[model samples]
Target: MGSGLPRSIRFDERVSERLTSYVARHPGWSGSSAANRFVDEALRMEDHPGVIFRDGPADRRAVLVGGPDVREVIRSVKSARASEPDLDAGMVVSLVSTNAGVPARLIDTAIRYWAAYPDEIDVWIDEVESFEEQSLLAWERRQDLLAR
Candidate 1:
C-alpha cells in the first residue's frame, strides 16, 4: 500500500517472506511500503530504454545502457569531443551510436545518467584505465625478460 493510493496484490509465500525480511532489515519501511518502493523503482527502470543496473565484478552495481557500460558511453562521447571540439551533442550521439551499435536514445540515456552521477562513472573509467596500464606494463616486462 502507498500513501497516495492502495492496491491489493498476491505474492507467493517465499516472496512474502522476503518482503517481510526486507522491511524488517530496513527500519521505517512496512512490507507494503517496501513492495511499493520496489515496484516504483522497477517501473522507473523500465521507462529508461536499454538501461539496466547489473552486478559487475565483485558484486558492485554497474549501469549498462545499449550493451555498453555507462563509463564506455561517457568515454566514447568524451573522446569524440576531444577529437572534434566543435561536434554538437547530436553529432556525438550519432558517432557513438554508429561506432558502438547502440541506438541514439540509449546513448542519450547513458549520457544523462553520466551527467547526473559523474563520480560513479569516473571511478569505473579510472579502474579500467588503471587495469589496462598495469596489464600493458606486465606484458612489457615479460617481453624484456624473454629478450634477455
Candidate 2:
C-alpha cells in the first residue's frame, strides 16, 4: 500500500515507545502494518467529525463520540426503515432518530461510518444477533428445567 519506496519518519521517544506497545497488542501485525492502520484510523476519525474507533472484546469498531455503538444505531435505523418502506434513505434515518431517541446528528455520524464501512458494521450486527439467539435458547432451556 505505497508508492514504492519505503520511507522513515521520526517520532518522539515516548511516542515511539507507545507505538511499540501498540504493535505488541496485535499478535500478527508488524510495526509497519500496525502504524499504517493507526494512521488510517486517525484519518477516518478526522473525516467523520463525531465518529471514533474503539477497541472491544471482539475487535475494533467505529463509535459515535457521545452516543452508542455505531452498529447499534445502524441496526435501529435499518429496522425502522423496513417498516417505513415508502420513505427514502434520509427520511428513514430521521424516523429512526426519533424512535431510538438518539439525536439526528449522532445518528448521521453512525450513518456516515456505515457508508464508509458497511461490511464491517454488518459483520458486527450478525455477531450480536447470534449472541442474542444463543442467550434466548439458553434462557428457554433453563425455563424448561425449572418447570420440571
Candidate 3:
C-alpha cells in the first residue's frame, strides 16, 4: 500500500452506470472486460484491414447502395432472427432484381433458395446460375426447332 506506483484507472459514475447495463445484458462478463475485448478486436482489424469492402472488377456491375456496404449486410443477415425466411426472401429479391434489372418474378427461384439457405448466399447464386443455364439451353433448343 505504501508503494509509489501508479494506480489503475477507476470507472467514473457515467461509465459505471453503462457498465452495469452491459453486465446485466451479458451475464458472467464484466463491463470493462467487454469494452476491452471490443476495443482490442477493433484495433486488430485496423491493423490488418480485412474485406469490409473491396472494389469490384472493372467489368463487374457493382454499385454501392443505402450507404451500407457488404460487411453491414453480412452483419444484418447474421443478427436477423432464425425464423426470418420472408426477410431473407426480400433481401434476395432486392439484390437479384436490382442487379439483373429484371422483374422480381424472374428471380423468385433465387429468393426461395435464399429463404431455404438463409445464412449462405452461395446457394442462391448457384440456383440463379442454374436458372440462367436452363433458360439459355431452352433458347438454343427453340432456335434449332425453328430452323428445322
Worst 10 residues of 3 by lDDT: 57-66
Q: Which candidate is the best by TM-score?
A: 2
Per candidate, the number of residue pairs that clash is 0, 0, 0
Those runs of model 2 whose alpha carbons end farther than 4 Å from true positions after fitting are 1-7, 24-29
Per-residue CA lDDT of candidate 1, range 8-56, in tens?
Answer: 8999999999998988897887887878767764664676556676656
Mark the regions of model 1 whose C-alpha exceeds 4 Å error after superposition: 1-13, 16-49
lDDT tens digits by residue: candidate 3, 5-111:
44375778897788788779877776666566555445633543331222443211111232322222333344443434556657755654565464455344333
Q: 124, model 1: CA deviation in Å? A: 0.9
Better of 1 and 2 by lDDT: 2
TM-score per candidate: 0.67, 0.83, 0.27
Q: Clashes in model 3: which pairs?
A: none
lDDT of 1: 0.78
Global lDDT of model 2: 0.86
Candidate 3 wrong stretches, greater than 4 Å: 1-7, 41-148
